[model samples]
Target: MTTHITGTREEWLAARLELLNAEKELTRRSDELSRRRQELPWVRVDKEYKFETEEGSASLADLFRGRSQLLVYHFMFGPDYKAGCVSCSAIADGFNGIAVHLANHDVTLSAVSRASLAKLLAYRRRMGWTFPWASSGDGRFNFDFNVAFTEEQQREGAVEYNFQRAGHAMDATPVPLPVAQSAAMTGTDATTYSLDRPGLSAFVLEDGVVYHTYSAYARGLDGLWGMYQWLDRAPKGRNETGIWFRRHDEYDRR
Candidate 1:
């Protein structure tokens, strides 16, 4: 009944049927997820968030300009850091080409961090990207999103997360770096703590006001409209996959 290389025609057919059924189950789940996504509700973003751009400070409402929907990519660039977040940077790299299409949907895409406009401009030049990037240098917007903090908050506890080797084993250790140091490392050319978290946020704009519709972090970005996990699963894969990260200075971001 259990021969390694000797299977009846009926047995082979049964195995194939199982595979087909599994595939069908996966498709059904995917369809259900999409339906749920479409049914999700939106929230109002009425906070007084501000952004620092080349033209100077602007409110979150101003970010919409005249659009109906506002999507903010909370880039990691505190005023204390030297550069921006590499993972966030990688995502930002994919925005310029897509901004054209986003504008067509009445949605404007932009990046906000606490880095100064001058620093952002220089880094943008170095990276050879043209997407609209701004700073929250003079505002508490970063803290509002829980991506930033104050001196006291930093002292409480800050265990950076690394995707390459986080929660994979039972004997995991925490890396403790000073708040200033950790914050500074994020925007620099050096590799950062790999096991923190990544997040996504969206806001809705009605009339001349904005509302915090939703905010998602970690793998919550999965299965969204613009999912790109397949590309990272390719043979060459992506830099953030596994223990695969190099200094930004070493990579040809351009």
Candidate 2:
């Protein structure tokens, strides 16, 4: 009852070899893109953004933690939400494993959210994550990075996200079913949950000044989602029809 094409071992090896060449070419292109990303002009960050960490209140520069480079995952955990975004949690599950390696290489990887430090810490403990998570509670850091929006922006029907003005789920009159479901999971309303979006931003500290290097949002974050990277190479690829993922802890219970 197998629906897939049946192939002999010899035929499969020949096709796989052909695919290997294409994969190698893609790897080379990815390397070139990495070089271009590094070449992008750096914008100086003068705003005095503050975040509440497990240690204490810290400024934006202090986020680097004495490292020259800082990579921040803009986790979607708004002040109103009781929990983090499921999709974001899925992405963050991989952070702990690579965080120490990045730190050893002089890069500090952290997650920043609008949730309170206590809330973040509670969720971090539940997930058993050791990586640094900071709360931008009542701070402009998330808004400045375009990862968090305001009620006014939502009512206006379009918000600048992923570097472009686009319609947000919060703007939907009835609120999309998926958004409602995700909001409920976060223990918030759709409008409130939609205010926070997922993104990653890079910053560098040079000569006692912090500089913005780059940022990526939405699908741009796919590369960092390890599960998707693995699924991409699977026989069926990412065969998703709807929101089928959950926070890692929720999976066993489901």
Find the candidate with the highest TM-score and give its number.
2
Q: What TM-score does structure 1 among the candidates reach? A: 0.69
lDDT of 2 by residue, 8-125 (tens): 9999999999999999999999999999999999999998998899889999988999999999999999999999998899999999999999999999999999999999999999
TM-scores of all predicted structures = 0.69, 0.94
Give the per-residue lDDT digits (tens) of candidate 1, residues 146-249: 55545543344343222222342211333333323433446532223222234556777777667676666545655332324665556454434332333345
Q: State, as a TM-score between 0 and 1, how close model 2 is to the true structure.
A: 0.94
Clashing pairs in 2: none
Judged by lDDT, which candidate is best?
Answer: 2
How much lDDT does each candidate structure score? Answer: 0.61, 0.91
